[model samples]
Target chain A: MVEIATIVLILVGTFLMFVAGLGITRMPDLFLRMSATTKVSTLGMGAVMLAVVIYFDDLVATFHAIAIILFVFISAPVAAHVIGRAAYFTGVPLWEGTIVDELRGHYDLRTHQLESVPLPELEEHLPDVQVLKVLLPATSPLAGQTLAQINMRRRYDVTVLAIRRGDRMITNPGGDAQIQPADELILIGKSAKLDEVVSILRGLAR
Target chain B: MTPVQGLVVFVAFPLLTIAVILAFVRLVRGPSLPDRVVALDLISTLMIGIIAVYAIATDEPVLLDLAIVLALISFLGTVAFAHYLERRV
Candidate 1:
């Protein structure tokens, strides 16, 4: 009786595992693959564990099987999350069919604001300008200087919205902020003056 | 019940474990990190099945403890791998 049960369990488990393997290979994107494997594999293995516990009829072994099932249940999603986050940070392009990119939308909205003004005062209200992104080149003249020394806002009429160093972001940096090489700078100001500011910063590097 | 029943419980289950191991090998050889992680997780689950089979075949209840330990270790390993992949560790 136990033997028959074991065989059945094994067959089922193997089938599930096979599906997981298929999903990994067939899925179009990392996230989709993760969804497929984590869910199916966890359940498949859990069933296999249960079958083993029944076959053995040993309290210790049963507990162990239960423990393993619990472990799989808790960890699979976490592993998927890690892999997804890593892929995102590395700039892996999402599958073409993806409909909504919440992260990109949020980032764009944060950096650019939309406002409504009365048409009667349309001429009085200055048009909103596009923001620009600039990288602090290795040879940039501002590389070793602090914000106070650079006087970037006064000189270029541009506001440094954020500074990204490696993976970390420094928001609303102070005047004493020391610029480092290879730091990505996000600036916002009038679009017409963007070239002028870029030129000035690039000139400093020379 | 019967000796044959006992044989099936012990022998058949172990054979299944062997199959699981074979699948695990494929997982390890997979081309991506997520594939590897998935395979490692499957192996851990198979280990639990093996322990349960041993306990029933031997009529030893203590094997459950080992199964529990295996489960915990597998969970930790998965979490660690995830964190490492995310570069958060």
Candidate 2:
């Protein structure tokens, strides 16, 4: 019975180790590879240690194996977290297919947490004329207006720098360039003016 | 050693060794710093596996203590490297 158990543990552990190696090699992105190596490889170590404890059936050996297993279980996740945070801070790009980044606009690097409070100080640091982007929803009044017809500069004190529609971008668009629903407009002006323009473009205004 | 144990020792050791080597390859060739760190941590974990298997094959209980010590030190190494990566050290 012990021998069967030993064989089972060893084989399973080795298989997990193999899977970890395969994952690291085959995964396309860094995050996926980290996910594979951290969790799977640690479990493999635990399995192998279990096999050792069973095979030796020695009290001291079992204690030591248990200790090792516990330590690994405690440390591996923390280590992975630190490394992943560093990777993110160092600007490692995510895979193209990754859609939601909860940390994108919410992270405060100084605090190392997600803060929902608006940061007016950040806007204060910006230049008097800065470019901003706002998406034009289908219901937005500005969606179908051409640049000349909207007269953005005269009314809102902002200039439309460019329009991003789908994958294409129109930079320095002519007066006749009509804004489309779902177009992302890049605007430039004073910070306050840009804020007003954003509200208007978002259809948050009367 | 019985036939089953012998077969396990011979067959599993080589495969675990290959696993360690594959992890080492990732440690060296990984595209990003975190990728390399993850691979490096795995190599140490695999080494722990190797130590455990060796202890069983040799029936040496003392090696199990070595495995425990290795685990502690490797954890320290991982944590230190992580701190370094965070530029906090």
Q: Please provide TM-scores computed only on chain A for all of the candidate models, following their numbering.
A: 0.52, 0.57
lDDT string for model 1 (A23-48, tens) is: 66566666676677678767777767
Label model 1 with its docking quality class.
Answer: acceptable
Clashing pairs in 2: none
Report the C-alpha displacement of residue A104, candidate 2, in angstroms: 1.7
lDDT of each: 0.64, 0.78
Model 1, residue B4: what's the lDDT? 32
Model 1 has an lDDT value of: 0.64
Summarize candidate 2's per-residue lDDT along B1-89 as a digit string, tens digits: 77545855787788778878888888888787777878887887888888787777777878877777777887787777767876751
Highest-TM-score candidate:
2
lDDT of 1 by residue, B1-89 (tens): 65534654655465555546554665766656655666676566656656555555565667667767777787777777766765532
